[model samples]
Target: MTYAITQTCCADATCVAVCPVNCIHPTPEERDFGSTEMLHIDPKTCIDCGACADACPVDAIFPVESLSAAQREYGPLNAAYYEGREAGSVTSGPNFHAWGEPVFERVLPSGFAPVRVAVVGTGPAGMYAVEDLLLHTGAEVTLIDRLPVAGGLIRYGVAPDHPSTKKVQDVFARFHAHPRVRMHLGLDVGKDVTHRELAAHHDAVVYAVGAGADRRLSVPGEDLPGSLSARTF
Candidate 1:
């Protein structure tokens, strides 16, 4: 029997450090680690130790025997990642600070107090809002996103080849690295956490969620197979 990591897995790779046999594929250091939607466990090498399940921060790992009917699909997804790979084939590199460490010794403004704030998204607008709030107001910001990974639409919607536009992700990354920022990835505000809960935790809530679906144009044959919306491809 083997355990599998599911959709809820954040790809943080905390479980990879604990597994005795290293059955988890795309470990944080792998090239695919940054791009993979979720982590996968190798069934052939798994010893059913359950260490991965124990280490998962989001409760995404589950043993084969314990998996609910709804989670059965993850079993194949996990195993498929390693179907053709040789044992111990995966590897990762050392953490190189390509962008030099941020200057931390600089003095901050006096009379600036930290304000508890909640930001509802992690996209360009949300990140920029948080960055401005922190730099200007010293607000303690909590950024929330529904996807397990942050960077919002940049992660899911942006095409990989758009490197120039993708550079904006670095801005979000800086916001995420700020000491005043707390990220709640994989959480849906109205579903996983309520507005009341946020109200209780924060002095104020700022909804920086970007515009939703693009306005639709109504015309004949709009539903044809070749049709695609500006908001979605």
Candidate 2:
């Protein structure tokens, strides 16, 4: 079976850059690039070399045979993307540079007003969403976090020595100063403030709360001082 792109794909296009056969459709250069929800692998043309899988930073690509139950549908979804393409649509090779950068313009409806959104977390994901929304719309964003200090696990979990990895924090920190973006720190949504409260203040509430929990082991001393999660270590 061919490789498939799953839900975790943020459309960074790293897979397209490394793919040898150029079987992945909708390269950033294509007309439907930003319009499509996710990138798709051409099952018919994919050589299944697994290069794209290696290049994916988020591990969103998988060989069809190895797909988990939740990711199985991605195989068909990848195939479906190609079905909608025009008959003559095909990329030559390594045309990612040709795609150029995505240009977004705000197209508002008549009598419309600026939207308001309350994001539940201030981590990379939430901030990235804020950055994307601000670039596309005239929306006011309220970033809510339970901790007194922001940055989430990125500030606490990442090693101090890894400067390059943590450098992304600097980029995210800029949103805090944006006029349309507001920060609500030391505020728990359910305990400090109700969901209804946020709903009354905004058009939508987005939960970008990251997955940082440590799973349990049946062995003794699992909670000992020496024991630590990878996220904490």
Candidate 3:
């Protein structure tokens, strides 16, 4: 059976890097990659190797046969992405994501002091920024979150039924204990620590705090009791 990419995709492109046959479409280098909500797998070219499923950071990929009733539509959705496009079309030169030359030069100048950075959130975005800083730069990171626990959206946003989706939290937890990282939880930015205070201590303060607004259905009784938004429930 072929694998399918579902809506939980973060568009991180980790899956694309591992697919041996290159069945996943719209590699990060492609012009359309940014516009597409999620990447799709070409069923015709998929060899059922499951490499993409293993590499997916958000657990968005799965076998077509295992899709639940709500997710069954994704199987067709993945196939629909390549309706008119020819097989092996993504492997062509223009769409191929080729590796670039690596530069070993230091980003910081000689005698430059290491900077302190503060990332405000513990979700995927915040953790990614933390990972990039620790791996690519010499910045010391201070991680902050209003909740007592970490894993902002991954902990609260995802449904409990989908345990696999929540597994990504383990990946983010690694950076929490990094030597260069200092974590503060249950600390409100404005009440506990003001923006001016953070700016004073850090070279840069990144606000990865996710959106708080809910979508409007514009229908009667949408706001009535027993009605719950995705985050509210």
Candidate 4:
């Protein structure tokens, strides 16, 4: 029997990055990914290689035979998710090969008034949002960050020895200079600017604030005075 993804799934799609076969449905490329309740494995296409299970961070996958009685219904549920849907193109993994040329088209309306958008963090997500919006629309993006520097983890969290990793932030440099993008640093949103004030000043506000917390350690003496989180250390 094939493996099935059960109810505890977080749907981060890291599993898709490792699967050799393109057997998953509503992949990250799909427009409905953010809205979909969960990702499903196609019973007909799954090779049973178990790579998706290995990549899953939450350990949500299980072999159909190994499923608990309560999860037995998931086998049919997974299959039902693929009903009437065709298999997707294999865009990832070592087996991936060249595909046909992609078509370019203009999706947004032409000559629309510039949209003033306040993006509430300057990490990779906020930078990507600014890049995508500026590429597609005449949006004037304002990046806001509480740190004096613009980049979130790229500027502070990443280890300094990993210069190559930090160098990738160079790609974001051009965005800082983009006429459409405005950078505001060392500004706490709730303290200096209220949500109401931001709403009144811009059409939309995007929060890319990185993870709010860290995993707590369970070891003895973990609470020692010198202890520091990776973000702080």
The most accurate candidate by lDDT is 3
Residue 75 alpha-carbon offset, candidate 4, angstroms: 37
TM-score quality measure for candidate 4: 0.55
Point out the worst 10-residue segment of candidate 2 by lDDT.
95-104
- Alpha-carbon local distance difference test for all models: 0.76, 0.80, 0.89, 0.79
For model 1, residues 30-136, the per-residue Cα lDDT tens digits are 78887988888889878787878876755788887788999888888888888778876434434111223666663567875567999998886687788778876
lDDT of 1: 0.76
Output the better candidate (1/4) by lDDT.
4
Which candidate do you rate higher for lDDT, 2 or 4?
A: 2
Local error of candidate 2 at 214, Å?
Answer: 2.7
| Leading candidate by TM-score | 3
Model 4, 1-233: lDDT tens per residue? 68888876657676776766667667787787868667788887777889988777657788888999998998999899888776655555565533448766646566667889999988878888887788877889988998888888777877888664565467677889898888889999999999899989999999898964677888888789998888778
lDDT for each residue of candidate 2 in 1-233, tens digit (9 for 90 to 100) = 69999876767677888877778767887787877778999887787689998877557789999999977899999998878665334566654223446664668896788899999988877887899888788899999998888787667777887554465567678889899998989998899999998899899899987864777777989888898877767
- Inter-residue clash pairs, candidate 2: 29-99
lDDT agreement of model 2 with the native: 0.80
Q: What residue runs in model 2 are displaced by over 4 Å at the alpha carbon? A: 1-106
C-alpha RMSD of each candidate structure in angstroms: 12.7, 10.1, 4.2, 10.6
